[model samples]
Target chain A: TQLLEQSPQFLSIQEGENLTVYCNSSSVFSSLQWYRQEPGEGPVLLVTVVTGGEVKKLKRLTFQFGDARKDSSLHITAAQPGDTGLYLCAGGPHKTGANSKLTFGKGITLSVRP
Target chain B: EAGVAQSPRYKIIEKRQSVAFWCNPISGHATLYWYQQILGQGPKLLIQFQNNGVVDDSQLPKDRFSAERLKGVDSTLKIQPAKLEDSAVYLCASNRLRDARSEYFGPGTRLTVL
Candidate 1:
């Protein structure tokens, strides 16, 4: 079973639209991270939330870590074609030390059409 | 600063053949990771190394897979008698020791087993 589950495996929206993607898990985590990946490339980190109930904003992107620390959400306001890519959420377990391993969701593929 | 580098961005091999992928992490990074990403799924950690020593490799299939990070700078992953299911994108990522939040990744090597 996948430790992390992502909703809306695929999403296509016109430019200027707003959208949200979710990542959920039954197990609690110490930190959750969001990443974006483009075609023919590796994923790049977008944000990291360490405290529950924390919310972070990156330009047009807003990321929230659930109060329970078991879920996360990414909301894009006025999405643009450049936002087209795969969104991935990864969770770091609490038990592991500082160099903890990460568990990743299957990911959400977002296609923003111009 | 140069990003993580990977060789042979694409590889094609027949089942039962052997293949290898190489990775060179960014300078000063002490932690390295190898991940396998099947189609439509997030990258799965196969092995992790810290300064040339194996840190975590629980998910690696020892029967047909092996990896090495000699000298603690660059790493290589090898698969012997490759299977169809092993066809996937192999990604390499690295971070400063004990800093799991700043991972940088390579473009990855896409492998196809015929």
Candidate 2:
């Protein structure tokens, strides 16, 4: 089973439009992170939310950690073509050392038309 | 500072051919990871290393896959007699600390089985 599930597998929008992606999980996480990837490139870290009920803003992107610490969301305002790529949300490891593994969502692919 | 480095940005091989990918993490980083990403899917952790020790490799297919990090700074993932199902992008990522929430990733090596 997928530890984290992402909604809206694909999204296409105009350059000026806005959108939100969701990542949900059944277990608690010490921290959650969002990343973006371009074609033929690895993912780049965008933000990390460690506290439940915490919200962080990075330019046009806003990230939120759920009150229960089991979910997270990414909201992009005035999305640009540069934002077009695969957006992934990953859950932090449950244990220390070897178990410090990351579990990722299926990811949401966003395409912004120029 | 330099980012994570991966080799053979693209690889095309026939089924049953052996393949190997290399990764060099950022200097001073103690945590390293190898992930496999299939088309249209998020990355899945194949193995992890902490200072030249195996942190996690439970998801790794030991029958055909093996990875090693001798000095904790560089790693290599090898697949012997690769199968068609093994085609995907192999990503290497690292973080400054062992339990850091943020991870830096490389451009990844895209593999295709003909």
DockQ of each: 0.76, 0.78
User: Which regions of candidate 2 are displaced past 4 Å?
Assistant: A95-98
Best candidate, lDDT? 1
lDDT by residue for model 1 (B1-114), tens: 999999989999999999999999999999999999998999999999989999889999999999999999999999998999999999999998655765789999999999
Model 1 CA deviation exceeding 4 Å by range: A96-99
**Which residue pairs come into collision in candidate 2?**
none
- Candidate 1 chain A: minimum summed lDDT over ten consecutive residues — where? A93-102
Strongest candidate by DockQ: 2
Q: Per-residue lDDT for B1-88 in model 2, tens only?
A: 9999999899999999999999999999999999999998999999989889997888999999999999778899999989999989
Docking class of 1: medium
CA-lDDT, candidates in order: 0.93, 0.92
lDDT of 1 by residue, A1-114 (tens): 339999999999999999999999999889999999998899999999999999999999999999999999999999999999999999987675645688899999999999
In candidate 1, position A102 carries an lDDT of 86
Question: Chain B TM-score for each model?
Answer: 0.98, 0.98
